[model samples]
Target: MKLDLTIPSLGPCHVDSPLKLSKQKGISTFNYSDDTQKILYDTSLKNFEACLAKGEAPLAFEKAGPREKIYFDPSKTKAAIVTCGGLCPGINNVIRGLVMGLYYRYGVNNTIGIKYGYEGFIPSFGHPFVELTPRNVADIHKSGGTILGSSRGKQNVSEVVDTLDRHNINILFAIGGDGTLRGVQAIVEEIERRGLKIAVAGIPKTIDNDINFIEKSFGFETAFTTANPIIRDAHNEAKGAYNGIAIVKLMGRDSGFIAVNAALSMPDVNFVIIPEMDFELEGENGLLAAIQRRLAKTKHALVVVAEGAGQFLFNNELGTDASGNIKYHDIGIFLKDKIVEHFKKQNMPATVKYIDPSYIIRSAPANASDSVFCGKLALNAVHGAMAGKTGFVVGRWNNQFIHLPIPVAVKERMKIDLQGELWWNVLEATGQPMEMKS
Candidate 1:
């Protein structure tokens, strides 16, 4: 197969993207198409904006003078460990490694986990924030959620820096996905402006593999493991039911990686919808028609839909839509209602159940493989922050824990290659509806 790539250059909408193909011996000539160029430019521009918005440095930008990393001698001070974002598996494991590594291994005792993410930086609600030592995190490796709670809130730069100053926090370790990193960066920028001495590092920790800044974010493998069982349970449960349809929803707020992966793993899934999958509202019967067609002689249907999929197009609970109607407490219910309506129209015997597997999968125990990867990533982030490096996120690349410059994390949307060996075959064989468009 000859591979060609297109980039927008020369003229806006006029010049075509250029491509170079690889043949047996060498590379091919440069070719261009207007459509390719336009797409290339548009994608690049959006990513560029994301980088700026996140305060992530550009991958292509060249560093000037005095741009070097700073190394902290851990023999002196303790680091801060924080977890933000929705709960994911292996979070406790990361803290376990960090606490253990800083205490017993490195002789640093003052490790504190910021409570409720950034929201718990200070004492409020009678909590006054909490602190963590190696003692508290000792048994956490086997635990599922965070020993320290997490929250979704606006960035509090000054207050966080003030807390750091009061606590004498020197090295900061932030554990979460992209949003948490943004919070970390906000604090770092404040410290820099105020001339405070501190180091910051971020651990990629989202069940959704959409953290583009890093490859193979932590908690992903475990999320996949957690997700597979739910899908399998649902898929198999379909085989034994009477005129039944089970619509299952898994978590992935803005990304569809989880949904795509789950649906592909199960061969019996009749319909799969993810944010990345192109879908539009059909007259109530369209989805029903698809389900009815996929209904086996057993009259049972299994469908896996991403929690965040089709959020903008449909209502989850009632006839009217609200602001956060984009999110649903039970996505399965939404699908089940529509499915039941379809069956009712056809006058077929029908029953529906909506399984909200959000917490079920995300709060489960860490898988062995995921724990290994999470530990390795946590260690690498510590090394990076101590090294005075800025902007890069720590993740697994090519089966190894590595540091990706913040710029890389911001600009690229990591996509699964649908034509690749394992992924391609698995998805195709199942007859799932994931569109393989770049």
Candidate 2:
């Protein structure tokens, strides 16, 4: 699908940047980015050639960094930050980064934290906004979750915009996933309808790494890294007994990036199931039969499945969550029961162990890699908002940080390509069947 990469702006930039950096290229000099700088959306030569052949310009995103001039006045600007949706590893790091970047880098000291997602904006909720400064946020990065707190569900757009106006907020930094970004879009619409000049900037937050046009979201690396050792533990559990089996379920609602990467990180995984691929249960070529075959030869097996995998097996209707997300059936427990039943029918004694580490992995402190990445995302978001950019998200694309319009970023989630190298590598690592369908 074609994408529009244009970023909306509040107005022309007039105030010079507080960051003093040498414009010329030198050993110690730093360069500032301008609106003209762009990063290509597609890096593949085939797609680039195809676009040129069709006489269409390759889509590109505006590069994210400090500009020579900004729109918001440092001394008078008031900014607020809010986090919504599920917990991730790097939320605190992002919050601290924003506060430090605003106070130390841009000379903007007037900042406040919105408590409990968008609900904090509604007057009826009676939630108080926390005043943010460099001192309080200095040590928040050592922990997980947001200091500002978070919640699910959508708030009324009019009420949210009303809060921003009441607080005289000049800029807003929203941190969350697809649902949160959609909320940002609605708030932006409301702000424009009322002819408000508040700048809205989003920092895409999803442990699943499913945001579109973003190469990798913060906390994803830390999440998969945290899961690697858990897979090893499952492998050890399987090896401790005869015909032993271990089933591990990881986080992935519509995509299986964490499951795929965690399985690849450890080679002991014998079977990898994901939402993108379908598998049968009761045939000679099904997952149960495959597990039986593996146990027959190795006497032990490890299966890593994404939470959204094998959803077709369920016949009952599941309701949606507070955030309007479909409630998925627990695939880990389902597999455990089916495997034990199949073995009992065959008169074969087996030991089955099921592990779900979804919450634990997501709520841990950000690792070194994610901490640095969170800092970059937060700082870039501050830069964009200070320069009057609105209705855009700060993300990494093709190894360069760039600004992505909220509509474009939330258009569709990034899913695994079955024919792509990442999946191919997973298949090669696990030695699992190409298809588990009967």
Candidate 3:
């Protein structure tokens, strides 16, 4: 894994040991640090050639905001905060953190909380605005749901723009998941269309950890840790009865981070199902067959399934929610029914138990790790917004707060890398087969 920078026809282009090279033709090349260059030099020739053909360096995340003046003057700045989408563990912590950051760090006391997401900003809805202060947000971090409340459904763009203008908000911080970020993107576009200089920043808030490129999303740790006891209960329940199978379904609409991580957290899980991988209910290595095999080895078995798993077996006429995300068929119930039916067909006595703890897991308060992460996300979002960095979501990348553009954040949903270490570790821990037939 080495690279020789000598050009074929031009002989050796003389340069310093450390040099900045830009592509001669295109403007798509990326700036590489000295360390990045060294890494590139140590890479394989095939990969190095591929990197050159792409006309960009190996991915690099730059800091957000411009090199010019800041966007807001503390004395004259007014900020707005809103929460959207489903409940997660750290929503309240984020609200309290943002309020404290604005009030104490920047001395901006004119922060307004928009209730019920974008709907609250519409004039028809009374344009509900709650003036926030340190005193009011003191104990909010100890709560679970957002103090500002939340809702789904997209609001009128023009009306939202009008409301922001009427409120004279200098910056806005949106706390939610991908759908919420898209909504924020619309608001920012409208503000730009109106020639307003208001800055918008998003705080990634998906408990599923499905937002692409974000190393970690707030509340995932809290949700995963909180779900451990539930999984243990399922495991214990399986052991209580003879020939018992317990299937516990966790949350993960599009991705299976929660299901996979919960399997990792609770090692007693005999089988784990996720949306990323496919498995069948019958046939040689299918799920039902696999459960029978496990039961042959042990009297009881515990299974963990993501809510979004085994969706291909369901009806084609699937539904969607307000965010336009496809509604997932219940994998837990489907697994339970199939297991029971298989046992009955074999003339074997068995008890199948299904537990869905989605609501209970998502509604819990933030744990220590998530509370700290939520605070960092909030502080960074506010700092980025105040610095005129708009149209970006503040997320932790490489263990640092980075301003990821909204478009990039929502471009693709992050799923478990089936071939990656995390999945491999899950396999090692659960002793599950890599593939279950087709």
Question: Can you give the TM-score per candidate against the true fold?
Answer: 0.75, 0.98, 0.87
lDDT of 2 by residue, 225-297 (tens): 9999999999999999999999999999999999999998898999999999988998989999999999999
lDDT of 3 by residue, 381-437 (tens): 766666666788877665655667787788889998899999999889988889987
What's model 3's overall lDDT?
A: 0.80
Worst 10 residues of 2 by lDDT: 21-30
Roughly what TM-score does model 2 have, to 2 decimal places? Answer: 0.98
Q: Which lDDT tens digits does candidate 1 get at residues 1-438?
A: 111221111112211111122223434632211121111112367777887898864333111111022245556676888788788899999888777766654456777777778776754433354567867677887878887888776555787888888888888788877667777667767887887777777777878888763446667777766777777777666765777777788877666677766776656666666655455434433555556766745488877777766665553454323212234444567667777776787788877766777887888768898888777766655544544555556665434444554544545455545455644554565564444222
* Residue pairs with backbone overlap in model 2: none
Clashes (candidate 2): 0
- Which residues of candidate 1, in runs, are more than 4 Å off? 1-70, 123-131, 280-286, 296-298, 315-330, 407-427, 433-438
Which 10-residue span in candidate 1 carries the lowest summed lDDT? Answer: 1-10
Order of candidate numbers by lDDT, starting with the best: 2, 3, 1
lDDT per prediction? 0.63, 0.94, 0.80
Of the pair 1 and 2, which is ahead by TM-score?
Answer: 2
